[model samples]
Target: MSGDNPVDRPNGDDDNERPEQSKGGDENNPFAAMFGGASTEQFAQMLQGFAQAMSSPSSGPVNWDLAKQTARQTVSAAGDSSVLDRDKRELADAIRLADHWLDDVSSLPAGCSKVEAWSKAEWVEATLPTWSRLCDPVVARMAEGMAAAIPEEMRQSAGPLLGMVRQMGGVMFGSQVGQAVGGLAGEVLGASDIGLPLASPGTAALLPANVRAFGGGLGLSEDDVRLYLALREAAHQRLFVHAPWLPARLLGAVEEYAKGIDVDTSRLESLVGQLDLTNPEALQNALSEGLFDGDEIANTPAQQAALRRLETLLALVEGWVDTVVTAATDGRMPSALSLAEAVRRRRATGGPAERTLATLVGLELRPRRMREAADLWKRLTDARGVEGRDALWAHPDLLPDADDLENPEPFITGASELAEFSDLSQLGWDTSDPPVEGTPDDNAPEANGPDSPGNDDAGPADGESPDGPDGPDGGEPGTDRP
Candidate 1:
């Protein structure tokens, strides 16, 4: 038998057997021979052994590679294959035409007018940064809370194990967000479709095939539909690029709300104790329901307020987008309203997207106030010229509150007075109730209550609580608990 054939010899045969000089190699390691028969598996085992000896834990941080790969798989599952060359060219041409038309209507600078086509997967790659910025705060909180929940005794004793577990948590969250973002990519036709500047600034993007598919059942000519969508995309980029601070302000609101996510260590423990993490769907369900159960930990008023802010901000952004897109469309497509309604329904009834994001970090990345917001913006734009309307974005104080949407005209046109749309800062409400002398920072953990995790790092105060206070967080509960 050839020497390579290890099984040829009898079990006890020692003749012709040679002891490897390399003392520390796992015998079965595939890479043992590359380093003078040192098995990589053996090296890992030895390192693990050393860690065990030292009682040190290792490994944490997300596996971005795996997350991105899984996101691609999610996109594939969505099956958006409609972007052909002709469709892309037609979409680009339409964006150019729409930009020309919008120039006559408003003074917003033309943002990268070269329209690009993005496949659903491409969309994910492009927009994942925005998702990451919005998601990382909460995910970090969740992961750290998980890390902290381990008793100090166990953390010190099982350092390596703890580290490994934390790394696994990061990887797990990354996968979760990727899947959710991928699913969202299928639904969105452009950078700002969800009103969060999901893609890079200045680059107007569209999913031609998806747009065509979205408009297909409406029975609109593909050309007209493409043109209409292009206008929407152009309009979004114009507002986003021109109003430089708006994106950060809006994104900050989301981050602020997420900062309030107090990891219910109790719920997390229960989930970690039972769920099969290898099965991502099961893991997803556990993550979504865990942190989002705001009622369980509705311990603080700050959380409630943060939730409200996020909802209101979401409403304003979505409302503005809807108003502008509608104006740009000029009811150009016979099916414009139909398509809008379909989009609204799709957003209202989130499919896998809800599960995907919820699992990642317990944020339900949806605009619950889209319809109300849309109606408010439509009325406002009708009353105020687009420039007059866009002036609202000049400062967050000018945006409508959740209450304002209920009776928009008063806020929309009747009150040019800054007092109505303005906040405690500009409305002089700040002086009405200064923090009592010796009052601790409200951003600080309470003096007597259960501590708010990392309350110190709560993002900018001008957070977007969105319009509806009702979130997976208690009503108006922000995905806000960073």
Candidate 2:
């Protein structure tokens, strides 16, 4: 019985007992521990956990489920209140009146098909899809850059652990987006507050809670503040609808800029060093607090060029909105000037949420030269009337560039010539060769409103760069990433 007892083995240990003990101890090796124990069931569970973490509500560059969850939690923490019935009625009435007033100042027709009053939480939910579209490419590129920054030997040695690094990056990005967006919900007065069409087309949405909070400091009546903001929203919708290409133009510019993002390898290397392979929860918590952020972006030439185009377009859009909104509210609203000045100041300094988003995404939607752009638009309206001023949207060729914003006189002086050229191009006639001085061709298609020219090789404007908006090798303005 004593010989049969494995525990009784002395200095002359049996080979069978020694091998059994060695095999059992192997289960706790570092490699096996990294895979969540040596048992096949344990390894399977670890993979299942990773899969669930990644493929929850949606899967791609970001963990959208985690993002939405975090955003709602943030909003709730900040005391979000649901939109009341009274709030909806007031916002709807204000928007309708705003549209009616805009009919006089704006050349485009009323574009508010629906007016919605949203709570801060609702705002987060409503804008999530647009946020996903704008942010995915940047985050994906960033993750790839982060992985590449790791030494090839380290990556190969890390092996299956690389998947955890990618998953960690997604979680970090998702948390960042959630916090920024949640903060933005409190700051934005309406869907287009930042001068982007964040909501559905023709859907003018206002957060009454935010509107009241904004007006509290202005000493203006809530009605006055609400109506003024409504005018701005209505004007934005009209411009977006009138120039169907504007939304794509603005969004595409952002995506193009994102393509040039260069991640900071040193910063990524530091992050990699801090990663606790055995303690994923600890690593995630540390990273989610912002070890990876836009501060790590290296400004490449392509990004700078793309930034210029984006700035010019954003300035033009906001300026047009400001000009038309001011015109609409000049005489009617007693606080129009005060309200407008308040808005300008807000944009100039940027709100807390705007700053957060800029830090997170490395992009600022606020136009730096919006005041100058506004002056140019006002000059165009004065020199060419509202119809002629707005006709610039007929084609991209006629729109003002950054230089035009600096010196409005040249653009205003040559406005007629530019208009003629744009009109000619719209007819598919070669602008280089002037048409015969004769009666109009009745069979030719009528010059429609702001529809893009069908011809691909339309000639460039005089003094305009032959390389197009950015540079010679630069892709088309607003070209999507291949």
Candidate 3:
């Protein structure tokens, strides 16, 4: 009976056919070419590796560990050297001196509690937390869109595989973000170089290597360049520290923009429909090229408003820093003007990393109105003096608005009035109250009457009051009376 039953016959012909069946399975696999004809065992191992990566606790909308690893690799690939001890000491000394110089020029107190030199990799690591804050909103939105785009029936059928797709998306986003940050690491001269407080508060860090590269072609001495850069960094720190509301406002604007981000579902659907899950590399390449970015999706009204607010705020901040640095270095550093121009050019024509970031985030960090903002600040300083100018930063509402950037004279002229009004309000003046009957109003015309000092009818003469001096024509004192 055992010989007759194929299921029970382990030593029968069926046992001899198992190897052929395994070979057939490998040959029929859709992923064979992607794996370069890997054997079944190798394929299984590959899947296991992918599963491990996907299941990694660090995996979310981004794999921060992988991002850091990629950034370090990028820094190495770019041949960025370590920060030497000499460079560190020199930078620290420059920054300390720069802070002292800033004290005489700015009303704000010293903002940097520590000054240090950093290697490119260090910059990436130090600034990545900020990068996460900036990037997560955009990534999360995309991930949510992707998950929602899947047909309900398909998602229900896919079950756990859908979760795997999200994991893959995280890996892809991390790779792209790492590349962007790595590129930035090589270019940024300091933690605050991008007009953002990307580093810890009161910590001013300079990348000596980038600073040296920045001065290489400027025909200026290294010391002067370092000092000038240090002044700018210190000035930025002062503003950030003094204006406590700034960091949150800037980051909040970015987050707000990202929250309003709406994907072009049609375009996203097309891209997703074309994705080949077996070849994850293609998805990465597409993301690197900005598959998520399209004019249709980028031009939403809400995004435009957010971008405008963010850009305006950035421009104002940069402009204020520029004005302060210029004032600080003006007669002290002979290379001040040259360095200022160089910075303007550098910002106007951003580096590769900036463009990459723009592509990744759909927000251009460059301050388009920086020059205007600088001019506004300079004029404000001239009109209002240092104390009044610095007072504008006491509150966000007190700061100049976007409209003020277009023609700053109004804001500058009105600053005193605004300040006075603010002071009055602070002093318990009720602005909403009607004017008292007995109080003299400068805006009101003088009433003409016999008792009024300037009344012609009460004067001793047509052109003179009783107490007036002789007329220009030297008429007798009372003869001019009409």
Model 1 agreement with the true structure over 101-203: per-residue lDDT tens digits: 7776654557653467988888877766566566666566667767656666766887777656665555554454454556566666677666667755567
> Each prediction's TM-score against the native?
0.66, 0.74, 0.74
lDDT of 2 by residue, 40-95 (tens): 43223333344455665235666667667767866897889888999999988999
Off by over 4 Å in 2: 1-58, 279-298, 352-357, 360-368, 418-482
lDDT of each: 0.54, 0.63, 0.63
Off by over 4 Å in 1: 1-61, 77-83, 269-294, 297-299, 351-368, 413-482
Ranking by lDDT: 2, 3, 1
* Model 3 ranges off by over 4 Å: 1-52, 280-290, 352-357, 365-368, 415-482
Per-structure clash totals for the candidates: 40, 0, 0
